[model samples]
Target: MNKIDYKSPIGLIEIEGSAEAVRSILFVERDEIVNTIHHETPEVLVDCLNQLDEYFRGERHVFTFPYHFEGTDFQQTVWNALTTIPYAETGSYKDIAVSIKNEKAVRAVGTANGKNKLSIVIPCHRIIGANGKLTGYAGGLWRKEWLLQHERTFNK
Candidate 1:
């Protein structure tokens, strides 16, 4: 799989995948050294970076590049529901569970949301707590808050 690191406003994002599809887009610590041998950047990865740039610049609201998620059926369902969240809106785990027709799976929905590897593209950050508070985010809650505020700034 090909890989590239993007210096996003929130932090460093490691984009990984093959020429055909993106596998993951995760935030990495600045000091962490990625051991992959450097190779030519795939066109798909380039497109993803470009779109990310547009997003951070407040010029893009949706991601159009191809991306793939590796997870269980339930996790995929939760991730798909996350995509349905509007660009500048927020939803709760219960909201996701309801959208997936598994309203009682709120906790499970939160678990699956944390498993989402495709970050902003899949929009796991949009999921807040049931009480309307920021909650768990693999990339850190600060980044989540930043992302939400960033989207609101652009969406207005």
Candidate 2:
């Protein structure tokens, strides 16, 4: 897959995919290196970066790029449910589980959420604790908070 490291407001974001679809969008620390790097940003990745720019600027709420879901069937189901979540709205793990017709899988839902590879586009940050508090995020809670707040502020 072709990859590009984009510097977003939160930090460096690694975008991975091929010319067809985006596979992942991950926040990276300073000096972090991914497995493979692409010298030229593919056409699909250019759209990804542009949309991300609009997202950070609060000019875009919904993402339209194609995505490659590379995970287990359950994980893919959970990820698809995540896309149904409206921008700037929050959902608990229980909510996700219930939406998937497995209300008892709250913990499992959270685990699946934790495994989401794409960040802002897939919108894992929109999921919160049952108590309405922020929870675990691969990009760290601060970035998650920033993303949520960002969406809330510009969700017109």
Which numbered prediction scores highest in TM-score against the true structure?
1
lDDT of 1 at 127: 89
Per residue, candidate 1 scores C-alpha lDDT tens digits across 45-156 of 8899889989999999999999998999999989999999999999999999998999999999989998999999999999898888999999999999999999998896
Residue 147 of model 1 has an lDDT of: 97
Candidate 2 lDDT tens digits, 45-117: 8789889999999999888888899999999999999998899999999999999999999999989999999
User: Following a full C-alpha superposition, what root-mean-square deviation does model 1 have from the true structure?
Assistant: 2.0
TM-score (all chains, Cα) for each model: 0.94, 0.93
RMSD for all candidates, in order, please. 2.0, 2.2
Lowest summed lDDT window (length 10), candidate 1: 31-40
With candidate 2 superimposed using the best TM-score fit, by how many Å does residue 114's alpha carbon deviate from the native?
0.6
Q: What is the C-alpha lDDT of each candidate?
A: 0.90, 0.89
